[model samples]
Target chain A: MSKSNNVYKDAFNRCLRLLDETKSLPSEPELGTLLGVSRTTVRSILARMEETGLIDWNKRNKTVLRAPRSEDFFPEEETDSLAEIIERSFMRRLLAGGAEAGMQINELELAREIGVGTTSVREFLIRFSRFGLIEKRRNSHWVLKGFTRAFALELTEIREIFELRSAAAFAALPEDSAVWADLDRLELEHRQLASEIATRFNEFSELDERFHRLIHRASHNRFIVDFYDVIAMIFHYHYQWNKAEERQRNEVAIQEHLAYIAALKSRDPGKVDAACRKHLKSARQTLLTSIPEGRQMQPA
Target chain B: MSKSNNVYKDAFNRCLRLLDETKSLPSEPELGTLLGVSRTTVRSILARMEETGLIDWNKRNKTVLRAPRSEDFFPEEETDSLAEIIERSFMRRLLAGGAEAGMQINELELAREIGVGTTSVREFLIRFSRFGLIEKRRNSHWVLKGFTRAFALELTEIREIFELRSAAAFAALPEDSAVWADLDRLELEHRQLASEIATRFNEFSELDERFHRLIHRASHNRFIVDFYDVIAMIFHYHYQWNKAEERQRNEVAIQEHLAYIAALKSRDPGKVDAACRKHLKSARQTLLTSIPEGRQMQPA
Candidate 1:
């Protein structure tokens, strides 16, 4: 698969949603604009729709035949880009608890396992190495540094430093800065999530990332903004690996976020600092508790 | 062409320095231990030395023939790893004033230009992306973010944050920690360089990196420790690009480092904070001034 055809597949899925809202498709150029794709892609989608009898195509006219059924849509996994596929596979192995520190990671083996080219595996490793979980050995393979307690501590340590500074910066943003409105939006989401925490707890992982990322962006420092990737990855995996008490944990976190948002809105650095620290401290604890005791020992 | 033979060439260069002080080569095992290579590599070194008449080799015995000439060593460029060579080449283009912000970087073109495999070039870009000077566009090429004023400011902002925290951590380290000895050794080197500032100012760039890196390591956070790479790269290229007041600037930086070192020794947080801020402020100013005014405009 050259480039995975994810762009076409994902766009086709989105185009199905559009079909449900209209009697007939718009002009090819207009549909291309709406789908954020090229004319070629739009034509391809129309061709596929006509072939599947989902639409009747007669020059300049595309009439919907029926609403797209669940079976009519492409499989959910087919729409993921190759990089995302590789990342999900790689992270699964890493967080699966069998990965040991100092284990050599073979690009060839990973490529074979993932059914992708070596170049893609190599590129994925290079990109993933920034998380500090894997490192390239000189003239050799990459080494797994393991997701140990020390790794969690190191990650949270930087996260706290960055988030604390960013929180203060967020509080100091000018009244007219667009981020205040963003904070308000996030604040509303936090409230909504808090009310439905019992059922919607799983969704907090993503919201947590966006909320912290917004504050980090306030620093207007690319490095600070970029460092969120590390925190996000760890939490993304942590949330998946340790599901026990997740609902309660997320519920408490939602409340903390509301407080944190209120502090940012108050534009009081002291309150922001306190709220941010309170939330981060609990987050660090949650991450630390998730690592298995056996894996927590320092690597020899 | 395969793996660059840099490990062997660089090791051979170090072996020559060892040969200069010894009459006969040590046992192959001993030589391997000292050179941090396998016996296979040690044998290759012996074979090359014997072929070049730099040594006389007999079974189980090898003797130095004459002092290794300058030509006996590999070319300085040949001793660099492929990644280093690619980075230098890439940065030269980036800092050469022709690389516009938002310009696309083609890996295949870069590989051909640098006379390396595309894999190496791709890997270098992935590693370099963490510095925030470049970003990978979805499903396409990497885009140059440029070394503009915003880049410098953002870099120094995190550098200051990380370094201050690390400096405080360094001061709080127990007396038994190994960093105290390292600091003393660096201080001695700083003093030596200070005395020879007129002639040795160029060397301060390397020392500056080591000094700051030592402090960064004290944080015991890999993210903080790894972040020094960004600061180091910017300064490495910045030092090469800006030549005005090089000697005087290094002289002042050396004094600031000494004061910073002294404050760390005193374990006075207030003094350390003041010294670190003072040095960083000047350092930031120096970096900001180096970017040509024309390149500092925000990308439209």
Candidate 2:
């Protein structure tokens, strides 16, 4: 709104961009000097970032927890929008405590707790309503819907079809396409994640989404791109349902991803299909185990 | 709602079901005796059915024009649901006159013409809003969006991938699955359509949807099933955009469908893939041609 405000916003964005290169933040005095801002202005921006869980500011230093994602690029505000903030908060809540079937979600309480307008929450809820993930009650409240094993199996079957097609298409893509360069970078990332699987296994979910989406994009099909959203939402969020074997599963998955990446690099249709199916089998098993035993059904 | 109303409703449902077996309705006096209702009740029900385009009652005979579909199973009224009726009406309008991008849609005027409340129309509009097919304007009005050639080509590419995977899966399915029965029935229908293609070319769209959906369902993938709705909606509705070559395209599509069916029946993965791709190529061509030439673009 003012020249000083613009200066701080730009600095905050620069700091977020820097997280992509380094996990540690510079000291407050050093950052203020680098950003050409006063220490007080730097502190205000850090506090906003801390509030949204983007970074952790300790007595001694600040650490990057998560980098700014495309969805976080808000022009009007230097911080996350109310929509994005609410979504992250709800996801964290769902992961911490599993939802029960037909569990009623109090809309008013959620709005009050998030300190966002009820209208925003209602619109968010309505958007998800189309996915059968949540249902709006007659009284204007919402109820959570739990996925059955059958549902996951059905989704996995579709995901396999989608990925196999995408993998084949990726292998067939021209060598000059930009996706080849991205594949190289993703392969390096997969290898890096594999090396640290013992400590950072939880980060595999985000990497897995990125890897599959990269392959899917090679097809250049809008339908697959749009539908992949549903697949990603369900698989990524529901990964929190059963965390007992998460580390072991993540290790296996990382290895599978390496195989998948190698197959794509080979650019052989037969080999790509084999590798894609192999990785999908592991994914299916992990998805099955992720569902609670009582809720799990026999493999469809 | 009343005894007489219930009787008339039952008779109307019975008449609709009977259309599956016969294309002609019995005389009113004979229908009254068969339904065990007075001639007056039969006449009232017939009038309602006629109003909904389910039948054509003339001076001497009543002919079954179209059978009742699931969307038309509204009990309290013989007509289609407000949502579907309005959707059909708007689609017809858009097809007859192409939608220009950013053309503002008056919600109140549409609701008035469709004999439905604004809320119903708004809900319907919101569902399609996610696809970028329509947009809710800042002033609470709506605007129409048109598909570019790139959009159709992208859809066709994804459709090809989906059907190819589905066909392969269908070929590998156990011989005892219910899909085999549907395939058998669909094959017969395809043959029937093929035999009469010269006269009944316009009916191919319905059968094409059924044939593709059967293959898609064989994979038992919920995401594919859900995403297929968008694919079907765009390809099916936009077919009306250019009717110049409609008959020829339908004839070719019918023939391709038959070959695709035979490939599936052979249970050979190679054959299935070849046949599926062949049909999809033709479908892509038809889709490209269906868009006005001025709107067509080089395939990505």
Candidate 3:
């Protein structure tokens, strides 16, 4: 198949939510601006809505027939782009075992197995190569450098370095900088999550990423900001595959984040460093413990 | 054309040097092993050598007829892989001016200009995106982020962080570690280049990369190791574009590197940090100064 219609599908899902607040859809141009798509894409969205009897469209008029049901929205999986699909498939194979170090990755075979073209597979591999889990060979296929303890250690090593520097930078931000406001909001979220830990602990992963990302952004360095993608990807998969003790792990993390946030608010580098170090140390341990026993390398 | 015959051309050049050492060519398998190519490639190299009158071959025996001349080797440009060619072409466009931030990059237009397939251009963009100099728009083309002062500052910020950590790690490595030996070798090269600074200052860029990379490798973190690519790319162009006081600047840098190397050998974290920071600060200043005046941003 060609590139997935994820843009349209995802936009269509968001448009359905907008319909609940009004009887008639706004003008096409307004809707186009609201949905952040071109006029052509907006028209396609309207056509799909009309076909499903969710709206009545005429050149400039679109009337919502009723509230959209759950079925009206595209499946969550279908809304993901082809690159995301390939990455998920590839990562699953990587974390599911049998993907050993130095194993050759065949581009054509992976494309066929994923039911996508080789170009898409090749592009995905190129993009994913940044995570350091796979490598391209000269005049040959890619290689799988297994997700071993060494990989985790190396990842956290950089994460700690970056996050610490970012945290210090965050603390040094002027009082009026917008990041202070963002820190306030995240602090509140951490408290809420901590209070509702029994039921909302699973949600900490997303909040955790946002909190760290906010701190990383304060460094005002694109490389530091971009480096988060690697940390986020590893944690994304780490959270998915290693679910054991996740709630407890997240609970402890929430408290650490609260302290970390408070330390940043204090605008003292020492407190920020200590708070960031404490949280990162625990995080490094959590990641280290998740690596499979067989793949764990002895510490140097 | 498909992938350039770079692998063959480069291997052929290396083979020429080997032919000078021996009167007769080695067995095909032995030649393949030595050149790090397959037997097929080895045979092809032999065929080219014989056809060019550099060697006489008959069944099991192949004898060198005459020393290979300069004309026997492929042009230096012809030996660069398609990706390298495309990157050089693209970076030239980026650094040559008129590449404003927020400008859309047309893959087809770039491919046409570079005389390569769109696939190669697309792959290059995907790979280059990690450098944060360009961004991919959803369902559209890549956007040039421009090589502005902001970009330079952001780059050097991470460079300082990673290098400082790496230097400390280098100092901490046990005496038996192979990296200490590597560091010693680089130190000797640095001294050799320093003594010949008048004629060899131009070569300092390559040695600078090697010395820093050796320190980075000690971090044993692939992310830290791989990050040197961004630093190298920017400096590679910076050295080419900004040549004012070139010899003097490299002379000072050579001295800084010597001091840094001495600190690493001393194996003291305090000394290492001081030496690394001193060198990195000068490097950062050099990079910041190289960014065009128009693209430089006021300090926030």
Candidate 4:
């Protein structure tokens, strides 16, 4: 929440959008001026952008302008952001220590919105539906179904332990080829996802989901993944809930995501972990601040 | 497995089981003699154990030993050894992408052997039932479910992605008083879970689940946890088939878990992340190697 970090985020998002628009990487200084931030932050952001393969990390000359083709940005294994949103909402309770939150979303629209073919959306739906996040109803229309507020608190508790385990596991990575490669890939994925900003909250939700899951998957621990998944499902919230941010906050969020991307690209596990905690802490603060006159943060 | 590592593991387990026999800790020479390993391996294992809080890693003016008392060895809120068997099964999949062929188990008898509460048994049944790993008819008898060879391989892909997200969020944690204490407590829980030896495949699987869940629960990232949950539920393996050696690998698992615990105690994020990947890799390799002649790892 520092003023400095905020400027970095703004400049970062501006560049991402600009890249998407121009289909070319712009001069680093250009983004800095456009976002009303310093050139230094912009340069670091650009550096991070390059590290993640979102743009090639430039070399030799100072005035690097050619950005990666927009086409290359979209990976072949695209995810459904909407499905991810709904599923994430459903899981919020699980992680928070609440019962499942269920909802059926429009697969076709959700897929289109996330910029993926419908194939992946259907698969996502099927995956969560079995777990009761999506349900078949008499109306024949997909509808959202579950919510348990306790999940949020439980999830907080679980994430604490997760960090501890990660702290343990990260340092202990075997000095072997595959394990080594996985560490690199995990760091790389973090860099890439942090740079791109989804047009909508739902889409961003999915990207973020894959982003974290990629880290866990790279560790290659199914029990860790599955256990995480269960608590997550138990704590899931609906897509409707992530709607309270002020416009300024939302803008700030895009930059934070970008900064996170930059941190990951640095390939310092300590930094990524720090960024991850910072991100979660902000949300926790937001939730804390948002509590109303009669509302408190406790199991509902 | 390396001969030295196995030798160290055997010695560690012997020391672990002898908790009631000793008033305090053992010395390095004593440990070396106990397991017939060289003095050097004992020193290394003891150092790692100290880091994990399995022992007090004080500056040894004369020697290394002094494994902590039982209460110091584990937290009050953790799952027991038998439950750990089941839980660690998940750990293997979460990190390593492997599931050894488990043998048909009598749920009731297995429950009694491990001394876990019956509720845990039922929870396992429910989980295994969903994956079709176990079948419980109307009469209430649990039967081993049929499985194909491809189950472990396919599960690895999904599990890997799950941990990646976890790692990202965990790496994000910051050193602030607001939530740092909670983070420390969770870390302690992870250390306890990470350091265990599975006596049975079924128990290992249970422990694996608990260990990873402990981490996910601590992560507090709804998006990361929920997405992982839905996908994890779809991925399951029956422990009804296994060779003697793979099952025996548990002999060394305790020491490995202890190493992870040590990393967490140090709060070094890089080491922790590496530790997680290393642990999971072991699990994945186990499953990869444990596939029976006719088995096919499941495809998501």
DockQ per candidate = 0.80, 0.26, 0.85, 0.03
Q: What is the lDDT of residue A151 in candidate 1?
A: 88
Name model 3 segments beyond 4 Å from true: A69-71, A294-300, B292-300
Summed over model 1, clashes come to 0
Give the runs in model 1 whose Cα sits over 4 Å from its true position: A1-3, A27-39, A58-60, A292-300, B1-3, B36-38, B293-300
Clashes of each: 0, 0, 0, 153
- Which tens-of-lDDT digit does each residue in B71-142 have in candidate 4? 433332342333345555433442343322454445577567555555455555554443434455432366
Per-residue CA lDDT of candidate 3, range A201-231, in tens?
8898999899889999987888888889989
Please give the C-alpha DockQ score of model 3: 0.85
Best candidate (score: TM-score): 3
List the candidate 4 regions with Cα displacement exceeding 4 Å: A1-149, A159-207, A213-216, A222-239, A287-300, B1-300
The interface root-mean-square deviations, each candidate in sequence, come to 1.0, 3.5, 0.8, 10.9
Per-residue lDDT tens digits for candidate 2, residues A1-300, read 211255566677777777788787888898887876778878988898888888889966688899788654446454454556678677666555556667788878888988777666766676666555566654236887656677677777667767887899899988898998998998898888888888999998998899889988876765666667777777766665557678988888888888888988999998899989998998788777766666622212
| lDDT score, candidate 1 | 0.88
The best-first sequence of candidates by DockQ reads 3, 1, 2, 4
lDDT values, one for every candidate: 0.88, 0.74, 0.87, 0.50
Candidate 3 positional error at B225, Å:
1.0
Instruction: After the best TM-score superposition of candidate 1, give how far the Cα of residue B69 lies from its true spot, in angstroms.
Output: 3.0
In angstroms, what RMSD does candidate 2 have relative to the true structure?
Answer: 11.4
RMSD of 1: 3.1
